[model samples]
Target: MFTIVLISCFALYFINDKEYQQTAWIVLIGTVFTWTLISYWIRLQESELYNRINLRVVNYIKIYILLIGFVIAFYTFLPFSVETKNIVAAIVLGFPILGIPVNLLVVNTIDHLRSSNSNTKYTLVAGVGDMAGTVEKHLLRHNGSHVKLKGFIKCKKEECIVGEDRVVGDLDHINDYLRNNPVDEIVIAIPVKVSKKIQSIITAADYHGVRVKYIPDYRGLFGENYKVTRYGELDAINVRQLPLDETYAFFLKNTFDKVFSAFALLALSPLIVVLAILIKLDSPGPVFYCPIRIGKGGRPFKVFKFRSMRENDASTGGTKSTQKDDPRITKLGRILRKYSLDELPQFMNVLLGDMSVVGPRPHRSFLNQKLQESVDKYMIRHYFKPGITGWAQVNGWRGPTETDEQRKQRTMHDLWYMEKWSLWLDIRIIYKTIFSRKTHKSAY
Candidate 1:
């Protein structure tokens, strides 16, 4: 539709200008390709845009602005008369102003008809708790929701909070029921305390490619920003999960990490080479230290770092923390550690996909085990890929964890970071790491 509209506008503008026939074709093709790419990037085909009028309007405005910019930029380089450019701009701008509403109306009407009772989705509820009952009531009472409750899958008959007649089957029969019965969506309204059972149900739903929604029992327990994800009007939350769990968020973070790491390595090649040579000359050991550190999901990966200590430093065993004026440090190592230059090699780890450029720093296996014994949520930090620098490090939580309280505090910061992660937040951390005064204070 966009292609047809754009090409029509282009033809209308350049039909009389036979000398600019090639330019019209170029503009038409470029506009269509650009809009197509932008649509995919913003997920315009997703139902949410069509269902939410305000979102649809906002996206249209954004796309219109982009189109205007692209047209002006394209014309700036082309040998076009000022009159021709003005005509093209006027024609292109009309495409969004007039076409967007028509497109929205068509999509909205189709969606409305599709969401009728005759076309309702057969939804299955897992668990018989108050949340499950609430969900069932909501689906039944809301006519526009277009959801039909098939039945509930209870954990046990005695434990069933809802009526026995409503209980279709137990967890043991969920797979069989899903196979025999036609279920479009599965709503898991279980408590966070029974996460193991919830996980199993979710796994089954995923295996069958069925839509799964989770309603967390513990809402206020989480940070406000990390509490709920809204699908249209239905709100759900995945307990102890980060936004990165979503496909788009994961893609954004991973893409940024790869691009930034690659660029940093390229731009800093000269410095990295100088540092590597200096480290090799200062220490008897290898220039780079590849230590196994626990990364995302408790997976162990070798983290790269320029060697900043003696060949066989006792601290390498994770028995002791590096301190001020440590004798294990080489003369060149002191400077490298002060400005975090020793961590420069970790760009390689970032490029290798073992770590991120910004996240909770990874801990050695021995230290991880020791910290896990004392700190209740120490291991939660491993839920995200480890980084060369982290929120904790920038906020004065870096250096040696001399006390259990220190480790606990650092873990708290790490969890908070994961809960509130964004592209801007990562950029903020990177900026602070380079400019903040406190960043190097605890370095040894």
Candidate 2:
């Protein structure tokens, strides 16, 4: 809707050739706003992840529209030259897009902290809906999150939580419980079910004279993804399904994986050869370690890395990740692994379509098996090919996860990267990797 409105506005506002030519960039911005709104609307139809992004994008559209309007008016009234126009265009174009969400995310977090006590409160998940689970996860922001414990309220007898949170009671008398107990808000969470049952629940909330708000459920929707929408001005939400699989995101990541991996392999061939020779002399193993790793969709393939362990190192087992003083490390291997040079040859894996340049690092068979059992959404990382270096690795998750918390944090970062994956982000990560490097004291 914003898209067509933008086009009509541009067409009507800038009719003459000279005027249109002068205002082309500003009007072109309207095209972006159009697409922004449309894409959000589209993603709203599919993935729950995109819905949040769509909201951010829509908010940006508002800001962009206002800025564009001001600039256009400035150009028209001030009679600025084309050079001035170009400067304005560049400045307008350079509005920090990715940073906007990051900023809002920070601001929202700070605001939340200011308004609410830092004390951890026990949250009651209501209605067994998407919003509830989302709220539950959001409430569990960090291991040290403010909301201390979590409980649930079941709307149906069949609905139950598998996690540690205890079910408190039914929502029918939820208001009384809230009044008596120090319970937080009774968040009305409904899944993607547009039925009379949902309508009746909304009516009940209204008749009760209590404040009720719902977040849409995104899981298990028929379409590719899920989105949250206001539910008929009542304290309910509509879960709209959308095309979930992001073809563009997948394509962009894959392209980078292939292109950069191939380039690194070809360009660094001499360095790899030197490393191989060093490995042969220093260690009693093959020049390279070809460990079988699980890739996208549970496909198994040998991942190439400059050999970073002794020949007798266990290839298959449920072993904790190596630390700074791992005995398994050979003399040369220690140096190689320290600078992440041992991971260099995984460029071959990337070229083979077994991995990506930027993604969740692939786990060994033993670890994957262990984690799939432990982490709730562990295997979702396999939705895309594992990366030679990933969001986890660069962001200080380079070494083994000895603690459950470390593993969970690593997995969460990987998932966030997947949820908000973008080509530009990948490039930024790659840039950071090359410059910042994942050099940590913990990395053995």
Candidate 3:
């Protein structure tokens, strides 16, 4: 999306002038083709052998439509003359006309290579019925050829339809069978009503650390709004999908973080340099301080900050919070903390994808564990990236989780932000972070 938008803007100027029309077209086409190839080069980042080609095509089409829509919406915010509209339309539409075919061809070729026998996953079906046969047939299909069926397992509830020679063992010995076999995944094709048997099979699969997939037979158990989704080619159901789980939301937030962080770092280089030098003069310690903090998915990562304290035990791995007029704070450090200049280096963290511009603030590892024990659903805040500034911070829940009420309120506010996140809300938080007195009230 960034590649398309950036090229469009660059081409806009030259395309408008009749003298540079050919040059503009060449630049636009060449840049886009280069990016397309780059995207293809790293396309196997997920390392999946077989891809759902239809799904890939659908995703590309959705992205293309989204790009066109974004362009139109963006143009609406600008004052465009009739000639500008024609130039913009041609630039946007013409690129996709040439790009889509090339994209599809590459996708098909890659899909073919990926679906080869070289990376086939040996799978075991934990039943021998119509559902089991259906799964076998599906695996043999063109798209699912990457999953090679090892054999079927006999079940008391279902009559064997597959050949006797294909039966690895009965469901009761599934644990033993998996322990001695090299199965990549096990598909449970039995009825959902057989709860006890299914539980036993799941336990066996879990013990053996084998991936488990189920044939969907629980349509009556869930609401219409709860739809089936895919994990690779295997169908599964989700009760509620978060906003960030959507592709466009993830792409938009990720793009905004990278672009905003890069721009902020470049623009703030002078101030950053001056501050680094002052930190060295003010205190005899490192210019940057990195302390481990709990991040997304409860993972621990070192958070970057300009050092604002005299080197001490607390400055390293200690979970202690700074207090009012703390003795450890240096003269320049106090000023930096007052206006949050100390946190300016965290833009590098944002650029590194360890943080976001706005979300729940990351807590120290010990504090995170303590909150998990004291507060309900506290860990849900870790579902997304921690931020330099957050809704809780903007709403005056920024500092010192000393009491239960403070901890609870901060977590509740963070959860609320996750549920109600939008670009506009992020903008509001940023505005308040700069201007709101409440945001700085608890800053030590």
Candidate 4:
């Protein structure tokens, strides 16, 4: 609708009559206003995650109807000549006639291409019985190219029909397997009667920040809060589905991350150059420091930052946290660290898709392991990409994790942010990161 009205206004620019132009402006404003409301009500901007082609088409049709009706009715009341109205209306109404179908076709084509591409989920099955095999078959049939079933975890006394080489380990060792692997999700295919075993697996999943899903054998097995989504014809319940788990939410955040990082880097390029020169002249080391940090899915990636400390073992991967009077920090480095100017280079990490604009701050490997052992569900923070500044950082929980209290509090704040995440929450975090004194309370 906006496109139609915008094109009409542009075309009206060449017309000599001011009256026609005025009418065009009014129509554009009216169409935009109507669409703003309609889109909000229908959540037209949200990505549709329908796995079924028919369901996607049905949704597209419903949206098309609402849009077509609004365009036709909106143009009818305009004071323009009948010929003008007809031409404008035809152009507006005629668009979706071909546009919507083409859009669907293109979307499906992209999906097909993506299925064979790198966004694949590394999955693990938690049983080796009939149900487990059935679940595997369904996943293969529906998302064969997208979901890579790494292996299966066998249950005690369960008959194993799958090949012996395919079994990674048994249920008792699921935690060890998860800790050493990059698993995205664990699908429990065992019977609901094995509640204790299921709880153990769920606990391991929580500790490792891997998603847990159940192939439901009973309707009331899962709680009301658990989301029951279709896996082809089968029903699967996501035990703890965060908003970020949705396809649209992922797309929205990822898109924003890329755009925001690109813009920030471009706008701050001059400042970055100055800082780079200052760092080089201030110290005898490199301008930028790339430290190994654990990112999404527990994958290790080098986090980019201005070198805030002397080049040493600690500068890259040492477990020691910076202290207030640490001699390792240079003069200019101290000021940079105090105000977080050192973190500007991490926008490059965000641009490279290794991080987010707002998330739990990434930690060193030793710190990550220690926290996983001491803090409950600490690894849950790693479920999403790390950020340059995060909810914890903005809430005054940004410093050393020497105490159990600090570790727990930081993890809790991160989990809270994950549960309550939205584009608005991210914006608020960014605002506080820039202006709030508490955000810098722990900076040294």
Question: TM-score, each model?
Answer: 0.54, 0.51, 0.50, 0.55
Better structure of 2 and 3 per lDDT: 3
Error of 4 at 92 (Å): 18
Encode model 2's per-residue lDDT on 1-444: one tens digit a residue. Answer: 333344445554656666545566555565456546644654532332221445656656665666677667767887757765664555555554443555457545754574366444545556665456667766554323445444666675434443434666665666565556664344556555532345555555455544445654445453333445556785432333312255665676667677777788789999988888888888686887776778889888888877777643365353556656778788887888767888897887777777788878887788899899988889878877787667777788767777798799899988888766777778888876766755344468
| Per-residue lDDT of model 3, residues 40-155, tens digit only | 65563232223455655555565566557745764687564555456556666765665556655765676666558786688999888767888888777534656678999888
Candidate 2 lDDT score relative to the true structure? 0.64
Query: Once superposed on the true structure, which residue ranges of model 3 sit more than 4 Å away at CA?
Result: 1-236, 314-317
lDDT-superior candidate, 1 or 4 = 4
Error of 4 at 176 (Å): 52
Output the worst ten-in-a-row residue range by lDDT, candidate 3: 42-51
The alpha-carbon lDDT assigned to residue 380 of candidate 1 equals 81
Q: For each candidate, how many residue pairs have backbone atoms clashing (under 3 Å)?
A: 0, 11, 0, 0
Alpha-carbon error at 233 in model 4, in Å? 2.7
Listed per candidate, the RMSD to the true structure in angstroms reads 10.1, 13.7, 15.7, 17.6
Estimate, for each residue in 1-444, the C-alpha lDDT of model 4 and write its tens digit: 445555566678788888776766666666567656765677655544334566556655676677678657656665667755765566556656664666567667766766774777899999887778888888776563667899999988778888888899998888899989889999998866564588888899999999989876543364333677888999777877788998999999999999999999999999999999999999898888887889998999998899988865564458678887888889998889888999999998988889999999999888889899999888878889998899999999997889878988999999999988999999999999999999998997
